[model samples]
Target: MNRLQKLTALDTRFFYWCNDLHRDLGLAPVSRFVSRLGDGVLYLLVGLGFALWEREQGVIFLQVGLMAFALELPLYLILKNTIRRDRPCDRLSGFRAVIKPSDKFSFPSGHAAAAFLFATIMSAFYPPLAPFVFILAGLIGLSRVLLGVHYPSDIAAGALLGVCSAVVALHLWELI
Candidate 1:
């Protein structure tokens, strides 16, 4: 197989490996919950909490976080629509995702992007929360793979996109 084909094969193998863990361990429920958390609500709540309770730092975080998401959303939408890569569950026969995906294409997982964006912005403002937020961001990405709604590469791309967006936002806001 060519390099691209080999990468695709690896992605499929990794997906099955994660799926086996999800199935063998009965982790669907937990995966669903974690995935749901990455659905943008938590990010809003985090921003709101900071804005309402944290004073100046909170306001700055809110602004930077909002900017990061604003940048990420359009890029994410464009890439997903342009690439139009099929989800593993959609492409692979005899496989159905544990939960319905939010959209059709899955080149870059929106959930993973948003989660990592939130984690990056949160870490920039509240350094103490870095470990927890980054860990949660990673879990959100893993949850997408476990639920079979996204390929591992999709998650990786989304994560890289997210971190880049946040870094840009931070720089724009003069916070980094």
Candidate 2:
């Protein structure tokens, strides 16, 4: 087998292990909750709430929210379509996923990307909260892999993409 085939085989085996763990824990509801919390809608609402409660902190929250959305959109809509990586559940025979995924490529998980992007952006604004935010992002990323929707590599790439996007956004913000 070629390199790509070998990777796929490995991913398939990993997915089975993930699937077994997911079934053992019966963590469907919790995973769904985490995934939803990592979504843009919650971020927007949280940003708005922060803005209302603490004016200065709210501004930072809003900026981070905007940066996250801006970064996520291109990756979700444009780059994913261009790259077209298949989800583990879709490609692997024994793959099992409790929660259904949307019609998006799985190379770089949107949830992972969004979670990390928000984590990094929030960390820049509130250093103390950085560890918590990063932990949350890491859980969300792991959930993607554990739920059989993504490979370990996919989550890693998504995290890298998120960090890069946040850095670029912060730099541009500084310039402006």
Candidate 3:
């Protein structure tokens, strides 16, 4: 088989393994909570809070966040539409996701992308929170898989996209 095909096969197996563990551990409730955190509301609030209440650094963070999301969202939409990959829930036979996905296609999961994007921004603005935010971002990605809506590779792609977006935003903000 070709390399892409082999990768898909392995990804499917890994997905199943994660789903199995999720089922065995009864982690659906926790997964749902974690996944929901990546839905954008919290990020917006945090950014706004920083901009309104915090000092100059907070304002800078909010600005950088806005720039990052502006970049990430467009890129995410283009990639999702271009790739048009089916989610595990849609593609797998006799398997359904624990939660309904926000969008139709799933490649480079938006949740993972948003989570990591915020994580990267937060880390850049407040280096002290790097470990916590990154860990939480990772959990958000893991929650997508545990809930059976995304493959690990999707999360990885999203992570790369997010980190890159944030990096670009940071550089742009520096120029301002």
Candidate 4:
């Protein structure tokens, strides 16, 4: 197999490994909660709450986070469509997804990207929350794999894309 093929093989192997590890009686609820947090609702509430409590910092947080999301959306879509990778649940026979994805293609995970983007921006403004935010973001990525919708590489790429988008947003905010 070529290098790309080898990497793809590795990704599939890692997905199964994670899936096997995910088999548990109690982890389902935890995974569900973590994944839901990455869905943007929690972030929206936190942003709005922060804005109400502290106007200046909250405005910065929302601005940076929303900018990152806006930048990530189209970029993620382009990559997903360009790569046109099938979800593990779709590609692997008998593999089932715990939740239906918003779209068919799955190369880079939008949830993971958005989670990390929000985490990165939130960390920049509130350094103390960095550990918790990143931990949750990491869990979000892992949950995608455990839920059988994404490969390990997809999570990794989404995380990288998210952090990079956050950085770009911060830079843009500084310029303005």
Per-model C-alpha lDDT, please? Answer: 0.93, 0.79, 0.94, 0.89
Compare candidates 1 and 4 on TM-score and give the better one.
Answer: 1
Candidate 3: pairs in clash: none
Residue 101 of candidate 3: its Cα lDDT? 88
TM-scores, each model vs. reference: 0.98, 0.88, 0.98, 0.95
Ranking by TM-score: 3, 1, 4, 2
Candidate 2 segments whose C-alpha is farther than 4 A from its true place: 1-6
Collision count for each candidate, in order: 0, 0, 0, 0
Give the lDDT of residue 25 in candidate 1.
98
Q: What is the lDDT of candidate 2?
A: 0.79
67-117 per-residue lDDT for model 4 (tens digits): 888999999999999999999889999888887877898889988898889
Candidate 3 lands at a TM-score of 0.98
Candidate 3 residue 20 C-alpha distance from true site, Å:
0.2
Q: For residue 176, what is the lDDT in candidate 4?
A: 93
Candidate 4 residue pairs in clash (backbone atoms < 3 Å)? none
Candidate 1 lDDT over residue span 1-176, tens digit each: 89999999999999999999899999999999999999888889879998999889899889899899999999999999999999999999999999888889999999889989999999988899999999999999999999999999999999999999999999998845
**lDDT of candidate 3 over 1-105, digit per residue (tens):** 999999999999999999999999999999999999989999999999988888788888998999999999999999999999999999999999999888889
As for candidate 2, its clashing pairs are: none
Q: Give the TM-score of candidate 2.
A: 0.88
Best by lDDT: 3
Give the least accurate 10-residue stretch of model 3, judged by summed lDDT. Answer: 50-59
